[model samples]
Target chain A: MSAIAAGVTGNNPALNIGIFAVFVAITLVVVFRASRNTKTAADYYAAGRAFTGPQNGIAISGDYLSAASFLGIAGAIALNGYDGFLYSIGFLVAWLVALLLVAELLRNTGKYTMGDVLAFRMRQRPVRAAAATSTLVVSFFYLLAQMAGAGGLVALLLGITNKTGQAVVIAAVGLIMIVYVLVGGMKGTTWVQIIKAALLITGALAMTIWVLAKFGFNLSSLLGGAVDAGGKTGEALLSPGKQYGATGTSKLDFLSLGLALVLGTAGLPHILMRFYTVPTAKEARRSVVWAIWLIGIFYLFTLVLGYGAGAIVGPEAIRAAPGKANSAAPLLAQALGGPVLLGLIAAVAFATILAVVAGLTITASASFAHDIYANIIKKDKLADKNAEVRVARITAVVIGIVAIVGGIVANGQNVAFLVALAFAVAASANLPTILYSLFWKRFNTSGALWSTYGGLVASIVLIVFSPAVSGKPATASTPSMIQGVDFHWFPLENPGIVSIPLAFFLGWLGTVLSKERRADKYAEMEVRALTGAGAEKATPH
Target chain B: MSTSHDPGTRPDPDEPDWAEVHGSAEFVELRRRLRRFVFPMTAVFLVWYLVYVLLADYAHGFMATKLVGDINVGLVLGLLQFVSTFVITSLYVRYADRKLDPLATSIRERVEGGAAK
Candidate 1:
């Protein structure tokens, strides 16, 4: 390992550079080809609903395994041990909700965007506007996380120091996603998702196998060695150990993270959109079952990678790295496997960033184009198919540019923190509206609008006030009120628990207060939506 | 292109509507039972998840207080979160199969059934 590092670290930056260029070129070719077939609005937004169950299932997993899973979980496992594994476990379990309640039903009802499901029974313009707003916010925050990770990966791989390099990668990715969606539409996006998913899973599995073999196939001893090597802090390198800070912080951190992953997975817009790719509701349900198996297999491998890093690189080395303790996966790939393997892994990591960011950009565009523009702005009265497709393509480009700028500004923050904030917003804004609209017959349009806005505002406000966002030190020496609000009152780093229920409450309250007769409206829409035969009514209200 | 169908073949009623009505009292009772089951089951699972999270956060003394081989109470509680998720999901599936599915089938029958006349 040392010999390979000595040989490659300073002398072969050119090799890594050449390999990275090839990856970008390949991605460019795929996106270009995909755009050729993107001729109509249906092709651009829904891929004409042509995906098979297994193909869409693989795509769903690709969408879920962002930089957060490939990089974040591996790093967490390296630093925090069992807690890291817990994150993957919680993530997989959330699929049960998706499988049983959401995936099939969503495919059966909506043409595009989550808001369509919520707005099917309500006034068109207000519902579309609310849904579009939620989509943009959720996608923007998620995009920021991926772009930040892209910047980090580029800097680490190319040996560049100036932070402007990070912004460059973000812009390049934003451009790729924009062009892909504009030209190739859903077909191109699905193929990219499939390829990227394969690359990520293969890279993770290969690293896990190599790391395990390094310990002579002895699992128990490897864990023991890691714990001992973690030093006299007596922190169990295999266990979660004492709460991270202030004696009780670890427990709160663990619970909040657990809640976010389990509930938040069902709420993600891009993940939800994958369900719309299938031909039927039953196919959508079948696709989710396949996703469960694929995710389960990948997460089991993450555990090995974490343990391997802990055993091989040691916890002290992980802590010493610049930026984060969670970057152990990439560093370990470099340490155990030579630069060739590391290059391969880095390429996979880059592909992951591209695939996930592209999915988010597309979903946001669909929300804006299909739901807000065609439905709300035009009142579902678009006369020309060609014009509608053109509008969607334009929206895709605009969303991509907005995300790139956000990513550049959020350069120095933790990617995981941004991702958690996105989850909080999703659970607050999207999940409540979706769950209520599907199950509750009493839920009115006023209720959906108020709750969505209420949840979106509340989660954002709470997150901005939390200590995680406070840019100041926890100690008194660096304390000052930014604006007039004190940060101490908002203790939890994530606000999902507080914000999600609040959205539900607002929805219920709004419905009760308005007393609008929406049951008949929804009943008709629901029947048609479930049956898929009625020509869509000219946008409701 | 043939551009036509048999003139004597009348349109099947189910072709337009997609389902048949089954409005027997037995079916209505079954629908009510399914809703009753799903509501309570969802309520129980949600409560269980909340209690698990709250106990982990607020009741630290118990978690920090160790058990065997430095395997503290907190680790056990945390792992239980995974267990609870699977348990809830399995219960949901079972409820759907036994109750929700049949009720939904009945509702579809009512909507599609010619007997609605």
Candidate 2:
């Protein structure tokens, strides 16, 4: 039957490739046109700080609502009800921190990256270097997840080979992203994000309403049916018992997942950089209000989609793609309707990957071009507007290539794990420095550097040693290398709890050890920054 | 940073004295209140996050500690994470309106006035 259907379709894999190419071409054209007026470093990194409140706000949410949120969370909920909702709740609540604490403050103080904030009251070299390194690391890890997700979706949706297809998809997405950032700069990136976010939320919400209507709006009945299908542990659907439920474990997985989602949101570098595009702190705060509303509704729809997938498609399909569980949403769309809906969902999924990767790539590029190369290594010598833009485009290509390599290396991994690792790094490296810089008077360059380094080192070390990083023989599956090591020792699949606090401590200590310079040059710079007086004195190249 | 002649805004290059250019005491006080509010709010949210994790881990013991049919203290606490987020955010905004907003406005006015002169 499968062969017959395949023969009837005359399944040309090139059609799928062509379909992807058309979108990439359209995106590049849009971005290239947008870049025509991009003139300065600020324009390249922050779109000349010209984004209106609503536009930037939507873009912020767009950059944030990745394939992980669209597919991973929904699939999780479909497979494990309340627990999955826990991820959504944790993710949404972290925005309160963003709205109230981080967004306005980041806008009021910094120019481009988290490094700008930390480097504000410190020397240029360490601050810029540290910031660029952190941005690259976070962006690279994030790109890995997006690439993994694209590969999985292509294989499932387009029937492209999982191995080679993954690489091709990763390269295509990376290319689209590079073109976007290189041409449109921040402006192009922001617009792409806004458009993709709108499509994703609308698509998810539409699919969700359709699912609920099918189930007769009976939440309990739907869940109960899923639970039955889940079998002995009742872990198949709507609850945690079927497979992911704690067998003898003490619910540590639950705690870790919760921490990663909640704390991780506040720490993301790409998301943090979005605030810089807006003109004012007030706009920054207002935009988040819109984001919160949009994100809440979007997540609510995910719950329906998850439950719908479980009740309709059953648990067996989900099990068949455990490592690629995030594919459940698109798969459910395919199963419920015809190929058109499936293609639309697939297109939406591809766009989601492209938009997110663009944000990450641009952020990483800005850190390299603006912060490290021009500002630190060159000591702000290439302050000419045109020169900076040229440098930015070159850096964008370089960062894209590096990310392509990283994604290829980390191929076949779980998308959720890659996302978690990115969050872990962000929470450790970026969050501590940002919070301390804005609030703490004693915070100095030394402190910021130590915090950045400490967080980066700790998270990297822990992740490297964790079972997720273990290179056990594929058939063994039992983590055969564990002579004295096991996943249980760490509890969570990702380690934010230990790393975040350690970073904070290092930052605080760095400040204390450094000599106090009251009303110093750095503090004066801070005064100018907060008041917008800094921009008046010298043009941001 | 550009030399704009728009009155009652933009800092004047001639004004070297920051104290004279600074906003009124009301503005300074608002800034202080804002800082104060942020500190406690951050602490409270941190605690709330930790409590969610703790309860989720040990909730099996208390899942049966019910208030109604199947809805127990554990379940309530689990959901309360969402509640506390809204509560804290609302409180932060209210505090800002009462304390921070006026001062911010005052500072803006002073800064603009200084620039015009």
Kindly give the stretch of ten consecutive residues in candidate 1 chain A with the minimal lDDT sum: A532-541
Clashes of 2: 5
Per-prediction fnat? 0.08, 0.16
| Stretch of 10 with least lDDT, candidate 2 chain A | A1-10
Residue A525, model 1, lDDT = 48
Give the winner by DockQ.
Answer: 2
Candidate 2 local Cα displacement, residue A353, angstroms: 0.6
Docking class of 1: incorrect
| Candidate 2's TM-score on the B chain | 0.71
**lDDT by residue (tens digit), candidate 2, A1-541:** 2332232123344544565566667767778777886877677788877777788878877888888888888887766655676677778888887877787767766777777776766766887788788888888888877876666666666676557767887787777778788778998999888878887888887787778777677655666666665666443333233333464332655565566667677778888888888776666666777787678778778877886777676656665653335656866776666565666677777888889988988888777777877676666655455766677688889878877776776665544566778888888888888888776767888998899999999888877766565544435422322334444334445677778889999999988999954345444444443444333211232
Instruction: Please compute DockQ, using alpha carbons, for every candidate against the native two-chain complex.
Output: 0.14, 0.26
Per-prediction tally of clashes: 10, 5
